[model samples]
Target: MTQTSNRIFDEMARLMNDAAGVAQGVRREFDTLFRAQAEKMLRELEVVSREEFEAVKEMARLAREENEALKARIEALEGKTVAKASKKTKDSEPPTSAPEA
Candidate 1:
């Protein structure tokens, strides 16, 4: 009876050890597969990281503001030029002809 019990105990321990080893291997394989898939997805998406996106957004905003300011300046300059030209035309007009001779 004792021999039978000992054999059974040993068999159980061996099986348990094998199962633990298999579980560890499976965990490692899953981790490796998940990491590879994540990297592939990131590459395929062509998405910038948050920090890079934020930086680009800030640059675009600054460019837009600058463009608007430049446009306003150009409009102001054009208005001044137009006013000066109108004034010059008014000043240069000849007087109406006097009565004949």
Candidate 2:
């Protein structure tokens, strides 16, 4: 009776090991399928590559920096022009004589 029980336990253990192996294989297959589907979806969605995204981001950053510099330059030039115009106006004005009461 003990011998029979031992044989049954051994058989059960073997079956469990086989089931574990099958589960692992199925998990691998599912992983592969999921990856393929994800890649296909990305392609369909027209997702850009990482490098392309980074390049566009960098371009935008550079453009912003250049715009800021140009704005500062324009402000400086306008300030100088305004100062020169005010000086000219002051120099061209004639002095008025005081009237006697």
lDDT (CA) per prediction: 0.97, 0.99
* lDDT digits (tens) for residues 1-101 of candidate 1: 99999999999999999999999999999999999999899989987889999999999999999999999999999999999999999899987887996
What are the clashing pairs of model 2?
none
What are the root-mean-square deviations of the candidates from the true structure over C-alphas? 5.8, 2.0
Candidate 2 Cα outliers beyond 4 Å, as residue runs = 49-51
**lDDT for residue 55 in candidate 1, whole number 0-100:** 99
* Decoy 2 TM-score against native: 0.80
Clashes of each: 0, 0
Error of 2 at 31 (Å): 1.1
Give the range where candidate 1 is weakest over 10 consecutive residues by summed lDDT.
Answer: 92-101
